[model samples]
Target: MSTLNSSFGSRFGLEYLPTSFMVRMGKREMMVCRDFRKRFYAVNPIMECDTGVQAGHLEVLLFRRWLLILSKSKAH
Candidate 1:
């Protein structure tokens, strides 16, 4: 998993991006991508976990926004 994170970080030049990526264990395998928008379209639903139970949904949303801000800053 660290290897995957490192590779992605290197590719995007965002060292903290991979930190937002997560794997959750529940009834099935789930993953949260570093980029929130990509997760909705490109990522499989099976790789998503229900965060409502732990109130983590808000954190995820905030982190996604942060990533977007970081990307935009880098773009300019």
Candidate 2:
């Protein structure tokens, strides 16, 4: 499979995964990094989409080192 380049949409997706230093979207979760010129990074898991095969791109963004995951929905 081809790797995805930086894009606005994919960058937004990374927001879902908190505490992620680098993220790359793909058929399956793969290793991704901002660049080979940085230090002090955190590793996060990448979630796989349940959609069918289609053209897609991965966007890598730099998140906070102490990022926290917020609750998706409030408990009733």
lDDT of 2 at 35: 29
1-76: candidate 1 lDDT, tens digit per residue: 3332221224334445455543423322232334433443433333332233222222223333432111111111
| Worst 10 contiguous positions by lDDT, candidate 1 | 67-76
Model 1, runs deviating above 4 Å: 1-26, 36-59, 65-76
Q: Give the TM-score of candidate 2.
A: 0.18
Once superposed on the true structure, which residue ranges of model 2 sit more than 4 Å away at CA?
Answer: 1-27, 36-55, 64-76
Clashing pairs in 2: none
Which candidate number would show the highest lDDT if scored against the true structure? 2
Give per-residue CA lDDT, model 2, range 1-76, as digits (tens). Answer: 9544433234234545543453333423332433222335453444322221123433233342232222112112
lDDT of each: 0.31, 0.33
Question: Least accurate stretch of 10 residues (summed lDDT) in model 2?
Answer: 67-76
lDDT of candidate 1?
0.31
